[model samples]
Target: MSVPVLLVVEDDRALSAMLAELFEGEGYRVDTVYDGQQGMHRGLTGGYDAIIVDRGLPVMDGADLVALLRSKGVTTPALILTARGSVEDRVEGLDAGAQDYLLKPFEVPELLARVRALLRRIDNAATVVVAGPLRLDRVTRRVSGETPDRAEVELSEREAALLGTLMAAPKRVFSRAQLLASVFDGAESAGAVDLYVHYLRRKLGKQVIRTVHGTGYRFGME
Candidate 1:
């Protein structure tokens, strides 16, 4: 498997270098830029799996960089690198299209977790679809069977995995722990799982998935 590429934009040379080394060690191709101008140029023009941008930059601000990228229709998932840990700052980053916010002085594990989460969301949006009546193609991540409802649906790998597990035992509830083991792998979150379930409900429509209220979630037998 080819290493996923990440563009790290931070004016802090030491920090960027550290991130490059860390991510490179974990099977990722890291491209690091230390100035906002170069960061924007690389981030916008380069093909990257994800972007980690610092909010403060020289020559160009990080927010402006992201905003410009968005204007040009760049939709790559972005994670903001901010020293300000205030809620308002985090909100600002999110509003600027930053998917997740990481404060300074965080551990490497947390960064890896957030990166995995972002990638999961991307992969999820390209896999799974309802083909036709009594037909589903969660594998190969596309709709092939006839009579597809013309609705665009995608499930994250984790969601697809969990759904597959549940389908293996249709009409059975799998608790949170079960799903954490069989589904999340390492980037598991109950809220993320619930969010994906909500997405499936919208794709499948009319209560196809049921929540057991206390235990976890299950796919209803068709």
Candidate 2:
């Protein structure tokens, strides 16, 4: 399996570094960004297994960021970590779409435990899945279509993640909005999704992914 990716959104450089080290030490691939705007961009696009976001941030607040992600169906598990630890604050955090809330000056063990608990709930997705004759490797970001005699084609990071998302839930019929939220991170427009669909079709072959008319796209036909 590919190492799970985690996104940490904290403005404090020192704290971000510390958290990155903490999670990286625990066998997770960590990405750190300062401020809420950057966090929103990365969180939406990184395809992280989990996210740790600070409540108080410049550009955008943690609650707003999480709310936007949730509105767009970016359901990556999120944990709100901030110094605001009032009873109402926890309720607000949870209401904003965070899976867990951790106060500042927290014990590392407790934090780790909460993260693990969130991750544990996810069905471990495979690193590779076959869509028709196309073989996609999420870990290596490689897609092999056609036959062995054909050259193996490499996919861009976004392409690989997008393909992985589709193949992971074969025939699930992901709408363009759903694909934008889960695959594109809610940053890219729906047209971007269409463009990638074209790109994937050109490279992998048209039959690899199916368009369900006005509904959305699915991986291979039944």
Best by lDDT: 2
Q: Which candidate should be chosen as best, given TM-score against the real structure?
A: 2
lDDT of 1 by residue, 1-222 (tens): 667899999888888899999999988899998876687678758988898888888866676566445433356788888888898777666755567889987889999999988766654432222312323445543322222275544556654555555543344466665555445633767676677677666655645567898898765644
Query: Which ranges in model 2 have alpha carbons more than 4 Å from their true place?
Result: 123-222
Per candidate, the number of residue pairs that clash is 2, 1
Each model's lDDT: 0.66, 0.79
Angstrom error at residue 218, model 1: 44
Cα RMSD (angstroms) for every candidate in the order listed: 14.5, 10.1
Clashing pairs in 1: 124-155, 124-156
